[model samples]
Target chain A: MESKPPDIQLRRLDDYRWEVPQTGKMRTRGLIYATWDMLPDIRTDQSIQQVANVATLPGIEGASLAMPDIHWGYGFPIGGVAAFNLTEGVISPGGVGYDINCGVRLLRSNLLRQEAEPILEDLVDALFRNIPSGLGSRRKDLKLTTPALRQVLRLGAAWAVKNGFGTADDLLHIEAGGQIPGADADLVSDKALDRGRDQLGTLGSGNHFVEVGYVQEIFDEAIARAFGLFPQQITVIIHTGSRGLGHQVCDDYIKIMMKAAAKYNIELPDRQLCCAPITSPEGEQYLAAMAAAANFAFTNRQLITHWVRESFEQVWPAGPRALGLELVYDVAHNIAKIETHTINQVTKKVCVHRKGATRAFAPHHPEVPEAYREVGQPVLIPGDMGRYSYVLVGTPQAMVETFGSTCHGAGRLLSRHQALKAAKGRSILQELAAKGIVVRGASRGTIAEEIPEAYKDVDNVVEVVQGAGISRKVAKLHPLGVIKG
Target chain B: MVNNSDPPKSKSGYRQLAHTADLGFRLYGESLADIFVNAAHALYGVMTDRRRIRGLECREVVVEAPDSGALLVEWLNQLLYLFDTTGFLGREVEVQEITSQRLQARLRGEPLDEERHQLNTGIKAATYHNLEVKETAAGWQATIILDI
Candidate 1:
């Protein structure tokens, strides 16, 4: 493990919480949820310092929080969460990340693992062929015209359903019904539009993938049943985001925010944390453009879902309806949302920034779909491709302490260079095959970089959240077949 | 003076740096203009094998920023925009003129032919995380982290 930075001091508040006291320009304290055993690894990076940095932001409420999967990110730590008072708070592009609304969607199928195991390779091949994956991959058959692309930006996943991509039922399980409000396509740049034109259905590289797996174990049978998951039942998970369009939007806004920060005299410890007040013209414009990019991401996943169903149809000759392939839930991990959270015994609207974090609204929250309102929002946590991913539910504790947020995934423990070195002279493919898992990838480097051991164990990450009472585990899914971009 | 006619085939100007969740590199050049050129080379180096690219196409690029840090990011992002939208990969970059406020360059490369070239990684964007551009005893040095 790398040595911890000496300046960061932590006091254990409880079994699963560590306190970074407010000091030196901080407006609030910093809270981190992690087991003691994970501290040595957590302290290995500058993420702890970033938590403190976030506390220093203006109008920050309660505390700056980091989840167990926390790692050093550009401005905010990955798995970081913060809430700011609407009047005095600031909205930053860094907090939402480059891949705006980068998220995951789960599709539960009626088929059993035994049924998919026989044709797993062919099934994965079909999915890989149907869904474009990798760097610079674009569909030759479905490039959107400029006007249609603008409609996609405006309508989000609704555009996909209207264009015959997926059913309206798919949107019901999505966060914000697969469309964030306040999106203005005109606020989005022409460059961003061009980048997203032909890239809608493509899964651009790096940690984005489509995986076929099965429910290996269930932690909460009632919640698992509520989520339409059963033991040994096959499932599909699509993990991606707004692609190049989002990247361009973020790049374009950082430049604008840089000047806006200076214009507004908002002090920034890091340039990446540059922002404008929530009510500022710059902030409103950014929010609008960001929502548009988020909508693009929702539509991207919707189109991919359409193809995933078609891939199954080609493989089994049974339709998606017969296979019972229905969307369980879709949640965005990287985003900022305007939420009403009670602070200091008063309810107020605050802009909540969840960077590399998932919103886990407590049971019966209105945002939770009607079907899942009793169990809370379904949170999908994807592990590294070779190991097991998890299904989790939001808890009241999370809503109270974390602005209804939880860890997104098994955060990176090793860099790409380290993973590549470790993978040397070893065939990662054959190794995974030996474990009875089938895999295909667009880039060899992406595969090596995503070696299972390169990340912290999802089991450990979920355990911390569960132990902390922030999120409750529902089920664990073991990978059977995978396609990585 | 470095030869403008020759491409940056040598790895001396830039070296990979370890970053936990992204790709990073340290660049060295004799002047700010040289570092800008090397930064573009390093950016493409992370995306694909630069050796396979040839100077078969040329494009003119211009960008402006309020300071050197933002300028560096803008310069790199412009090259990335071209690559993402037009499939134009840069093998050589020549900064014709540069200041803290503006930069103009001539890019030489060919459009990406996936069948002929080996793509290694996909970079999302260049970040301002601990970004630096300075003149040291060794001349000019820059540190950049690219989100992948």
Candidate 2:
């Protein structure tokens, strides 16, 4: 209710970290991982106050944490991470964001940039055409019956593989094998189902996009080799989520949680932070429904991957295997996963909420795919369409200090209105074209709103996390073409 | 003093508000019914070009919530569901009866014709972030943040 920013003191923990000491009703301290230079921009918004607000949540295991890419968000600041005790903690839909399991999936192609340069425009067009994008984007031909849609909610990417969208082996590189256990279709409301029914393969509007890029640099050769990424190698990144289904799920449950918060006597500082105890019926149901929506997102990405592969085939006339179109890895940025972590020297299972953050499990973790077990989980951080995105690997430091979490993407520096005003007469498409990147969007308005100036330089965000030892950079990707929805 | 016999019809309208990451709108009206109608209008206005849309058909919408705030969220989400499922965009919404607990209305618009109307953005859902409806000296006012 207060528009004025809260006056809070930040004690410098190090060059890359800051701390807000436990005070008042806060159950723990608030920790933010960002450089001193970043703090100036970060402090301009109320996200720091939000970090402190989150510390007041009951059963919060570690300090309420924020990654370097932190920015103002509804309940939790974007890039916020918090782990809560399973029995005593609460689940807030806002923590996972409205786009449940909104994530990134990368595909490695053996084709070098030189090999694809001639066909870059054709490839971009093919992708833009094959993959439905923009507002109200849907696949008219891929309509699913209610039962089939339920199976998608239950089986996730495996359902897509079974339906010939992709191969079963592709599932190995996906987080949680692309299917989270305990997802119950029965928990998903009919309205949620109806909303997602035709949206399975769509690249919905706003920041969602499909990028065709090439590995421009490599920081860790060993890890890069493991990920099948090499300098000059082509790759495709699909960024989307559960579409309308996830939105409705969060919307529906937020109302329930608002009531549940009152019913459970959980005092919410902000109404958007509405939540319930993890063991309560309301919490359990929300988790079940959220998992279902997450599965839908997984399947949605898998189907889009198939289309991306098809687009490549159409352009090259070479089989996918020959082109070496292998899935590198997929990571969900918005999600709540029950994971085991050591807290106070005790291995305890807790629900880790990552809103605008990614899981960066350390090397040798059981959850990391077998191929990547020797290294760490591959974390994808997509930047604005005009700039370079990074590939990072998890570290033990991340596991111990931040519950194995890292920044999701470049945090916004300018609001949409500001971006639009800045881009009043300039041609955004031309600006990107000058940078050797071909771009397409549903409308010019979205393009103007997403100008590169609207976001913080992702390079700085990545540098802060790497400097803090939360995640190690693996590779950098330069976009050759982009399709925005 | 202004004439009290005919109070100038308080303009019912809405305007987009600046948000760092998502979309926000502020709506105001002379009465609760006017604000509800304007809210629907503003939502559709953000999604597509309302000028291109014609009121070719109508559908009844009925929803109930525990309070006015939740009712507003439910009302907009219901419209989103209709758009996602049946491609129905509300060119005009007439509120027949509205209370804190219940809302009954008729939404008049044709199914989305991509060729005729240009969509601006896909709104996921109306959020509860600072969602509030209050009576002010001028009239009724509500602010909604949308997750785009």
Candidate 3:
């Protein structure tokens, strides 16, 4: 296949990590996490230039980082991660991207993978019906009143559980315990609120999906068992985010961050790096709103997750006991979090922006859930609905070198237009069905636009991180069914 | 006329549209501050059919900025806010002047007749994906895309 990687003037550091030094207007170096083989594709991309451009932003710390699945995006490239000092630096909405808290969650089941393979058709149809998808998809049952919705903004997955979506135990398995602290409802616009009111518990369009899969391989015998992941075991994955409200919040703030850069006299090579001092009023309001939207994203998934569990009840007629469905863990992406990172042996608070990145915090980080703290945060990276996904765990190297972050998914290798054109004259469903995966969507174009070939090999992307020691692999998941928007 | 009693601040403001763009109306000013004011008028015009948005009684609209660029998105957002909150629409707009941080301008349009306020794509906000407000050799210029 023709590779479209950018010019990454590389200096190999090892078998895993490589560097792109400052050139042009770059203020710092750029880092690309890939193996020697992947370097050829990295060279074809212009996204490396974006990484250097990102380093030029005022007050950026460490290096501008891109994961193996790197590709050009609005401002920052997808699979990008950067941290800026709040006391002296700025925040770019482009760094966080417009999807807001777009993320992924994994659910484990007691049933063996062999059992799921046969009933995958029924499960896929049930999920597609329960989760309204495609562009502008909404539901009559999930809409919330203004007051109830405000609570969602504050509560996140906890709100969903409290409202009968799941039990309190589910929160223990969620990132940040399913609720980001410091979300302020007052920071949300009424229009944003209105957009989200009908969007909760619903999957919005473009790249959002639900996949049913089974563990295909185990990389580590010890970790796989500790994670309860074994070959041929059933698993479910959900991917979505804060929807319109988060988009509006970033929209509402990007312009402010732009002007704030000028007011503070911060030199920016790209205007898209608009930002303010973390302590500034403009910055605080945005954080509050962003956090609130992050909560909505968490809660949205929690509600949908409940329905997924219920789906098994209706399909198998014996609930999880017969169907064997269980919650494994959930994780978030596309978020800016104020975390304490040690710089020069002293801990300082920095707002780490993971635009298309995921937090892979190592074991014993105080915030990690008690049940899994001895192991590490479970990082779920979903591949295309038609192919496979993986289960990974955070490592100390991530905390020491990358600030506890890693790649999010199999980044797109083709744009929607390109994918649709490539899929022309091909029945994408027939293609997937032949491969043993059943696919369904609200529109034909959705399937065509998301054909597996539209994405990079997720296995390759995962290998880059595991090789770099930022994350460790546990199990591989091959798809059986898909439901997407 | 916009009741520009104060300078348009960061992440917030209002301004007038000028004859700057080639195929579209423009928001021109001395600084990012005032240009945002004109941006509001330009977007308001696009939201309504220019013919229908013209000649409604104009009123004073004031917006507070959390900062400058936020003020700019806030300014455009305010136009949507007015359409959403007050039902006013814009047809033709005039910019008096833009400063390093504020804009003062005039808008001529009719109140959105009850039926015109529903053409929303739920963008709910404007972003800098393709946002450009530059001081060119010819004059001040800017372009913005709303995420609909």
lDDT (tens digit, per residue) of candidate 3 on A1-485: 01333455778888888788877767778898888887665555456767887888777788889888777655687788888887676676778877788899898887776776677789889998888776556666877999999999999999998988988988988888889999999989887887677878887656788888889888887877777777888888999898767776776677667778788887776676677777778878888889899999999889889888987776767656666555678888798899998865768888898978999999999877777788988899899877789889999999887889999998776655467689999999998999999988766766776788888889999988998999999888999888877
Looking at model 3 chain A, which ten-residue stretch has the lowest summed lDDT?
A1-10
> Docking category for candidate 1?
acceptable
Total clashing pairs for each candidate: 0, 0, 34
Task: For candidate 2, give the lDDT of residue A354.
Answer: 97
Residue A391 of model 3 has an lDDT of 89
Q: What are the DockQ scores of the candidates, in order? A: 0.45, 0.45, 0.08
Write down the worst ten-residue block by lDDT for model 1 chain B: B1-10
Query: Which pairs of residues clash in candidate 1, taking residues 3 or more apart in a chain or in different chains?
Result: none
TM-score, prediction 3: 0.79
Each model's TM-score? 0.97, 0.97, 0.79
Supply candidate 2's per-residue lDDT for A212: 96
**Candidate 2 lDDT, B72-118, residue by residue in tens:** 88899999999999988888889999998899999889988878888
* Shift of residue A64 alpha carbon in model 3, Å: 1.7
Local distance difference test values of all predictions, in order: 0.90, 0.90, 0.74
List pairs with backbone clashes in candidate 2: none
> What fraction of the native alpha-carbon contacts across the interface, defined at 8 angstroms, is recovered by model 1?
0.73
